[model samples]
Target: RVFDVLVEGQLAIPALDLALEAGTYTAVSRQYTVKVSDGQLNVRFATRQGATLVNGVRVSERPDKALP
Candidate 1:
């Protein structure tokens, strides 16, 4: 939260709600879009960043193998 207020909050982005969460991250500089497919079975994040994390742990710089 502090990072968004102090650092991210200062960003000149519009309609951007920066939040720390999980999943495949790909917003380079917090710019991207999200899409839901597979009948809520999968989520697609189309962003500029390529960092993906799970359980708050960075698993890879891009989308990792889906865990079953």
Candidate 2:
């Protein structure tokens, strides 16, 4: 399945296919840097091909190391 993710109403992840990147039932992760103007953080997922599914979501401060 494929989908798009939006954070704070802006596009963050586009055309994500979990089964193609990682095998079914495997874990895959993606991280993005976004500034929170408001106290709330919104994450929205839209299906591109099939139904979109998410296992979990995590929110934390940016790490010292930069993302590769």
Candidate 3:
């Protein structure tokens, strides 16, 4: 499946395809940095090709070890 990830209504990921990147049935981890000005974090996935599939999502405070 292919889709676009939008953070704060802005395009973050143009097209994400798990099958192409990690193959079927494989787990992949992705991280994105976004600043929430309205105190709300909105994550939306817009379908580009097929259906959108997401196993999980994690949100946390900016970690010093994580790159921006």
Clashes of each: 4, 0, 0
Residue 4 of model 2, lDDT score: 94
In angstroms, the error of model 3 at 31 is 1.5
Greater-TM-score candidate between 1 and 3: 3
Candidate 3 residue-wise lDDT, 1-68, digit = tens = 89999999999989988899889999888877877888889999999998887888989988673545
Candidate maximizing lDDT = 3
| Candidate 1 CA-lDDT value | 0.30
Where does model 1 exceed 4 Å of error?
1-40, 56-68
Question: What lDDT would each prediction earn against the true structure?
Answer: 0.30, 0.86, 0.87
Worst 10 residues of 1 by lDDT: 1-10
In candidate 3, stretches whose alpha carbon ends up further than 4 angstroms from where it belongs are: 63-68
Provide the lDDT at 58 for model 3. 89
lDDT of 3: 0.87
Lowest summed lDDT across 10 adjacent residues in model 3 is found at: 59-68
Worst 10 residues of 2 by lDDT: 59-68
Better of 1 and 3 by lDDT: 3
Cα-based TM-score, every candidate: 0.18, 0.82, 0.84
User: How displaced is residue 50 in candidate 3, in Å?
Assistant: 1.5
